[model samples]
Target chain A: MLQALRDTLPANRWIRLVLLAIVLGVIFTPWLFDGTRALDTAARLSIFVVLAASYDLLLGFTGVVSFAHALFFGIGAYAVAIAFDHFAPGFGVLLVAIVAGLGVSLLVAFIMGLVSLRVKTIFYAMITLAVASAATVLVSQLYHLTGGEDGLTYRIPKVLTPAFKLLDDKVFGVRVNGKLMNFYLVVFSSIVLFLIMVRIVASPFGRVLKALRENDFRAQAIGYNTLAYRTTATLLSAAFATLAGVLMALWLRYTGPESVLSLDIMIDVLLMVVIGGMGTLYGAIIGATVLMLAQSYLQGLMGNAQDVIGGVPILSELMAPDRWLLWLGLLFIASVYFFPQGVVGRFSGPAPKEATT
Target chain B: MTTRVEPIQATGGEPVKQHRAWWHRPDAQAAVLVPALALLALPLTGDFSAWLTLTLAGLAMGMMLFIMTSGFTLVFGLMDVLNFGHGAFISLGAFFGFTVLAGLESWRLVDSLWLNLLAFGLAAVAAMIACGLLSWAFERVLVRRVYGNHLMQILITMGGLIVAEQLIYVFWGGEDWPMLKPAAFQGGLQWGDLVFEKYRLLAVVLGLVLFAALMAVFKWTRLGLLIRAGVENREMVESFGYNVRRLFVLVFMAGSALAAMGGVMWGLYDEVITAHLGQSIMITVFIVAIIGGLGSIEGCFIAALMVGLLSNYVGFLAPKLALVSTIGLLVVVLMWRPQGLVPATQGGQ
Candidate 1:
């Protein structure tokens, strides 16, 4: 049966279609049963998918490993919180929050890009790290503006009408409310962003960016303004990240430093990219989905089986909490060691060998 | 290949004569006298008590800085691979040291000052060995594959750091472990009106000794000669059939050991060991290493001291300013001398 399916879906188009169907099926799985938890998991996974895709613009295509991409995401979330605090609530305010967040990220990215572009690889990572650290400290210290570690809490508008719809009270025997509405909102946003990314990657601009990555010096010699192009890409990446951050804030109905911008968030995004496959756009979505699902299932299983160990209850306690990050780390190492292509890349084979000619 | 300007020809032949000047020589009497006099007079001009405290604290912190950056510079200078996970090794050492000490306390072992010192010494050695072996394995298996690829090295080492940190959180619960300074070394030393912590003074003395020993080894040891040669021309060392891979491993291990030692000292000094220490301070160490030049020991030493002093002084003026001072220093250094304070004679690719 597997062989027949593979044979039937030999073409890339058919494969993509099938993958899309699987994703939609998973997204709409809540309809089948009381999978409220699964719906929440999907929403969280969607946020990560957007984040990982944003990172791919820099990490996969440009070959720059930024350690501070979360700064933009955090800024976006904070922007929405701050905007909601002052402005009247509406879709227009949400749009303004996103723009404001993107604006800040762009300004920061531009300065960082200009300064660190001269230093590639490790040096670039160091510079970006410094910026992120500085930003974190600055935010934490600015007690008045950032709520000083207490974080800001804002009342999200109950109606997200135009962009989303709250189905019937018991639509298909499932309660449709904030969580479900937020679920659709995130899924819709993720699909839209994914499509835009597909278009961007397929464009002539992406080809030039790929060339720049393969051999930057050669690209420059061939008359490409490497720095300008790279800077543009960085800005675009930061803008998308901020947008995802805004969505995250809306989904969670709260924004805090821990939730939005932290080293852990950066690590999660990096894991997603690596596990999914570097360079491939769809890898982001696949990586985020797989990782989140694994985490949720593993945690749930461990949590439920805590009493099964009987005599050594400490074992279960040790098994359940805080082991996820450790497992993720181990997975990252194993992935690098065994499956360097990442999950998606391993299955897909190498990206169509780029034509140097 | 395109025709490239040689600029400065590689120095190949005889060892250059060591220049000795009264004020210029690193070990000169004036070299010590000038800094000593400046430090002594610093209190008169500033808040005397605050300056004294800051100077002492700076000295203590400077030693840790020296240890951290020295490993970073040595590894980068010798291997041309930036071990981004160097901080993880430091964190591992601190956590391991704390665990051993805590275990000893629980077991009702000799709770004497001497025993504590012994425990610390044993922990340091164990951490060094463990970190060295782990670093060697990592370099051999993963780093070796990406010899010339800086981007891959950065990403891989980053992944390594995340793994190590997460493993640490798994093994040791996510609570801070308090460290006890030896009772004999806990009290402050009184000299005239100035009071200083004996432990901090001990740290400074130990750091100086280690620095001297490292310099002596670099000047006289055969392994050191190979390292210097490898730094200049890795290919040439390989061509000579000197087991270049072994040398790389040795350098990386030594670097890891140095960072671990620093971690032990930092834990003792701070009186607490947390997994986040490595991630929190790693950036500052990197800044110091870069500002000092990628692989220069003397440069790292000097840069660490300057940074320690600068950070303390700035923190005194405004605490928040301390956060950005090192980054500001890094930017200035990069803009002025992109290579660093004392760049390698042979330029980097």
Candidate 2:
């Protein structure tokens, strides 16, 4: 099972150890942490790992800076939420929602890819930003169907809900209810998706993507269809992100623009992929975990420190919870200048230098 | 960066003025589209007065959008750098303007138009100065380091934007602050069947004046010629012993200051201010920049106007289409002109 879980291993032994610890940490979270938030964090970590790694396929490998990623995620979560809102909550509904999510994401990605062929690289970012901005506006304007700013809440299958009991007794001081099942469902799917992504990136198709990223002229000269490869990457990444969104929706039993569709989430995915290490799945994994941990604990830690500092107006204001973004931004800039290869890239030996593109 | 256009020599340098149709000029054709759009929307609106009002309002909106995007276009043109953090200046301008105006509330409360204008001008200048200095530091501390690395430039500038936004929150608090309109500028001027908001008229007059000033500077000033030459060939300009880097810093500061001024105008236009004001309008800025042709001030102006007009028209004609009208316009325009209405550098961007 452990062997099966290991897909594409990190090259560095230290990275491998970190990866194992992360996996172990997640697996034993139910035993290690006693609160609901801890379990929620684990679930979020699982989802973000898949999300960030998928983005790595596009930004890190193919060099496409898309701003429409959150739109794809929103599509996935909205599909499931809408499906449950309209139909009876059950396995059948879940299957339809999942299928709907993937289909729409693929279609949107395909259209975006085609449109992208017309413009240069930087223009692609502009188009995507415009599209994403328009989408949010449309969602809010068409509130009757999308539930607008209020968002939508719907029930999942009985088995996935907290009231459902899989076993009569408590397992290791934890309730063996549907919440555990939901967590395992997310974790299981996440691991499988992560492994699949790793496999995809390690494949020949990924090599072509890397080549294109390095030098599109050379890649084209080699007879590779650059457009087709780029579109395929977009599709694959969008599909995986959709799956992550589906899992998140099912776990929370709610979907909202802020939760799944905001530009902030897209920024997080970018930060994770870049700061973790571009062009490496391991980097993405590490980036997601680091971000998740920081987001979860940084503010609380700052608040504690602020209490210690007490009534220093400027210092306390600086340490306030809202100012976390300020510190995060500073850290992000420091990393970009200091670790151009990203954290994983710095720790893992330099990628076989392909003459720096 | 794309290839730069060649200079048209005036003294017997191959008679270049003869074989031309006005329609062939991309800029000429693009400029005509703005008024043409208003004409088209007139019928859809079905009321002459409503059409006139909406058209005027749309043009006013376009002017403001142009002011907002003008600085970004210059920065992109001269430096070939895409500053995603341009929004930080916009937000800063708004906050600074708000603070200044709050301090000058006494001057703005009176019914005297001169006093009100004076107060507004002071607030705008304050915003401009604050933003210009901030931009100088931003270029030095953050943007300069990421030169030539677009990815890092984008990431680093975005980080700068985030920090800037947080600082705004820390200083001004998280809630949206109400932007007060001066007592003298509150009412609309009425004419036979047509009406104009005083603020919108001010925006239009100010926008046109600024646009004309920008054009005149570029055409008449040695500094403008140098800047234009620098945009065309930075290395050549540098070779000619002019410090292009210093010129760039100067332009960056000025551009950011204009953007800050635009932010002040926008706050007055919206009658509100918030930290996320820049972020929310970023999409419009990007669309304007792209549609206008990167680095082309003329193109940015035309595109901004078109977007502003189309948004107002479509928003009134078809409520459902209002949200996505600009995107739809982008597709249609791109289909017509692949590199935008006017490509600043030339040869395939």
Candidate 3:
């Protein structure tokens, strides 16, 4: 059955190879580079992978442009943090937190969708922007509950911290500690979440969603309740985004408005989706890796740029670490102009058909 | 054959009906609504003087917003382009206008009101010209590439905004500048228990003058006719031997200039300016634009007044929930109107 499953995989050999390499690389990252930093980066990549994929559910498959996605992500993070802070930090608490977070996300998604979906594309986008900004401000002002801009830090399950070592001795050239276990948990859940998303995208419901995105009027003409389909897609996407947010909180052991729900983060998600490729799920993975790595490494390079160049006046100013966003913005525009289909689209050649008019 | 015996009395009835319909016109009704709302609030606040002050302040705020948003609404109405980077022009205007004012410090520091006004006007014109030229290039290079695609237009323009913001940082450093009002407009006017800021009053007067000028140009100009015709049918206008594309570019430039003018006023109002002045204000600007309808200047103007008043009232009453109230207002407006308060198109958004 495993051999048959391998045989029936899509003929995209390069993509499969890339995926295999990534999974193996992440598994061995602790042994490969600096242990804690490598693990942390891998963990972050996994969280963003989930984020990018969930975003794709709306932007790529559903073709809905929403600016309030990070609101759900923030809610999930806050939920987990609040739960840990108020209740016991145990597995059961975590379970309840996940459910609660997802429930709230679903409810918010439904109401926002109902209100915003009535408008045309541009207006819908604007309304979401307004809602998102308001929610961000609310989160900050409700300092008692949300920790405001300073954010909230909490204890995870005892099993996930470095104090609780899994073994007294080293294993696989690395210490078997609670941190390692936690990293593994993050990677594992991310893989599972990714698979579930893949399954959903491959389903019949997903196909109908694609149809609606391509031409909603035509889909309506064909007797499909486009609104219902869109609302359901929105709910599902919000649920997954919240899960990603919860995972992020767990991995970081802290969550805050700036870290989890900033408009900057929303724009980063957009950059990831567009740079990767909109409709292709594999693009999400690739985009997340490229952006996260660039952000991490380029920031370091920028800080030390003056020392390396030694008084090249223009280069020194241009390479200031704080100026990363400028470069990212330029990269975003170039990608949209030169690669409307994104990197994945370019690599895969032309699409089977036009996904949007 | 019966048409030959039409009654002259029916002709008299037509004039009365037309006059009555004029009162029902959306703009006319909106004009009444603004004053009526102020009167209604007077009793609630129970301080006629304070209420009057707040209402005037709100109108001043609204007029400034209208100035900023008019160009955007007009450009979108005529061109169907969604320029998310419109806010960048606002920031540019504020910065350059400040530069001009600072350079003319000799005039700004004077006790003479006429000299101060001259300095202010020159600064405004300088900012407008700078933004107008930049907007021309923006449309030619960035906007031209993403025409007809709303999604791409939004993304690219957002990219443009970020880039512009970073460039501002590069040129002007990442520090907030504290702006000072000119010597002539520094003090307030007092009448018994009521006191009003001189600058706020000036802002109100300037905004009204600009509004009147725009109304006049639009009402009695050949260019206005072409623009209205172009918005209703771009292809038809083009077929009529007019260069509709040039008109679009002109409108975009005009919009950018107006945004800059609004920015200058806002900077003066806030008394502080930052590199992200545009980005921070964009949320409220977008809300106003949405509430005013996508492509209607008149609608945008009315919505701006309502939002400004709502924001001030809410801020006074519930400081913590100021933003919440504004967003709540947006949701309610969208739910009730859907097409906004005075949608440009009669049907089919």
Candidate 4:
């Protein structure tokens, strides 16, 4: 158990403590937080943590820049949603969707890696962008199946709904209701998935990935089949993203193109990974929490500012609730330019050596 | 017998003697796709006139796409920079033209060809200036720091694209605005049973003129020669005592202005300007650039036409699959010639 713990914990004590606090806070959200909105936010925070961390594996560790991560996420979401629509709302249907989503994501990621990974980095990025855009169009156009752009709303398993109860008595003054049960399902599973990701990153496979990320040609010179390693990383990242999508759809009981497949969500994911600090899973968790809070609260603040500055002409428009994304964009730019290492990297990495001038 | 198909001097510069062979050269062979697509689409339409109308419209659409993609491809070829934020300029141009034309509605409604032309021309000029200026800052501010790093360039530029797009949303409201056409160019001319929109006709003419002018710039002028040389090898061009960085900015601004012009044309054609117009058109622009072979202007033209014709034909036949058809064209072309229809000979091709 100690060896397993060592494999999953961050090397930095501060980072590890922060990760622990975030995870414990999420696990106990039902007892600590009240209201449906709070629960919903906690669930989404868990899902986005997985999403951003999986993206980090591909982007930070492997150094393969892909724009189709959300496409895979959408596939997982739509697979679950469509399955629920067609079949009875049961655990069996959920299982089938998970399997199908994973299979499809692996297949697509494998083919994409083989085709575009052989090319230069720019070519790969452009092709993934093209594919992602095409996927969005297809999703939007297929209204009949995907419920069009409006998306689909379906009931999940009866046990997962708020009506069902896992226990007759309250546990720690928190009712053992179906909603709480479902939230635990998402949060606990997310913890497991995240720790597995940590273990993988600390494994030998991850060492090869590090070599490739630092210098591709040098890694290849050491007799490592670099292409195979890159493709495996793509597959692993896609699988995790798909699971995150599954958890999200299962929790929300709805799925839509705008929610899962849009470029905006992809942008949000990028912001999380880059701002959180690439290559650090703990940083991803921190990034996701901060972003989710900002999203929940910043837009409301902007709305108030919009009213206060209503008479200020152009400035009023900048303060509108919808304009929060403008700030997000600027933040993304600032992070990329000023702190390429990200928030976690800023503090955790060693200080720059003082010049002996 | 030996074949003389190989480039005699592989000085890493382009424009080899192999440009003459139509049957042998892959890019030249790719050119046949335009006619081939038009002819194949002709019989499917079941009438010559319908096919002609569709083909003409496609050619015009192709021209605008070429104009938009020409700059992006050149930027990629010259700087080795994949500026993902290039779409923001297109959005900027459309909004700029909308603002300009919105102010000149009186001139647009006058019904005189000169006034209408003047109104539209002024809008184009204004839009180009706005887009050009923004592009200059875009290069100097956001793009300058991320040079030489492809991953950072992609991330930073994408950030720029998002910011630029959101800024447009801030300035323009969240709704789609319908663009009003000049009275003189509102309707098409009836040549027998077929009706050709005057605006689309102008698009074709403007596209041709731009192409000719760009070709001349590439072939004749000192600026053109320098740009071509820079695209082939930036370090070599810089080593030759020329200011390649300044030249890059000039070419970047010019290309951005051209994209903005395409946006203005697109706004006129589509007649509805949304904040997402740049994002939507970028899908096609990227595919065209990739299919044309990144960094090859002529290839961009051919691929744009092929994509334009195929999309129009597909839109007519299967409206739902219009975007898919362009993607399909890209897949097919990439499978056939992975480098693009006209792969640039140097600069990481």
- Report the number of clashing residue pairs per model: 0, 0, 0, 1
lDDT of 1 by residue, B234-291 (tens): 8888898999778878888888888888888899899898888898889888888887
State TM-scores per candidate. Answer: 0.87, 0.95, 0.93, 0.95
* Model 1 misplaced stretches (Cα beyond 4 Å): A1-18, A26-36, A161-169, A174-181, A303-321, A349-357, B1-45, B103-116, B346-349
In model 4, what is the error at residue A310, expressed in angstroms?
A: 5.3
Q: What is residue A25's positional error in candidate 2, in angstroms?
A: 1.7
Show pairs that collide, candidate 1.
none
Question: Clashing pairs in model 3?
Answer: none
Complex DockQ per candidate: 0.42, 0.59, 0.63, 0.53
Residue by residue across B228-346, what tens digits does model 2's lDDT show? 77777788999999998899999999989988999999999899999999987878998888888888878988999999999989988887787599988888888787777787764
Error of 3 at A293 (Å): 1.4
Worst 10 residues of 4 chain A by lDDT: A348-357
Better of 2 and 3 by DockQ: 3
Fnat of each prediction? 0.56, 0.69, 0.69, 0.69
Superior candidate under DockQ, 1 versus 2: 2
Give the winner by lDDT: 1 or 2: 2
C-alpha lDDT (0 to 100) for residue A25 of candidate 1: 64
Please state the CAPRI-style docking class of candidate 3. Answer: medium
Rank order by DockQ, top first?
3, 2, 4, 1
Instruction: Give the number of the best model, judged by DockQ.
Output: 3
Candidate 4 global TM-score: 0.95
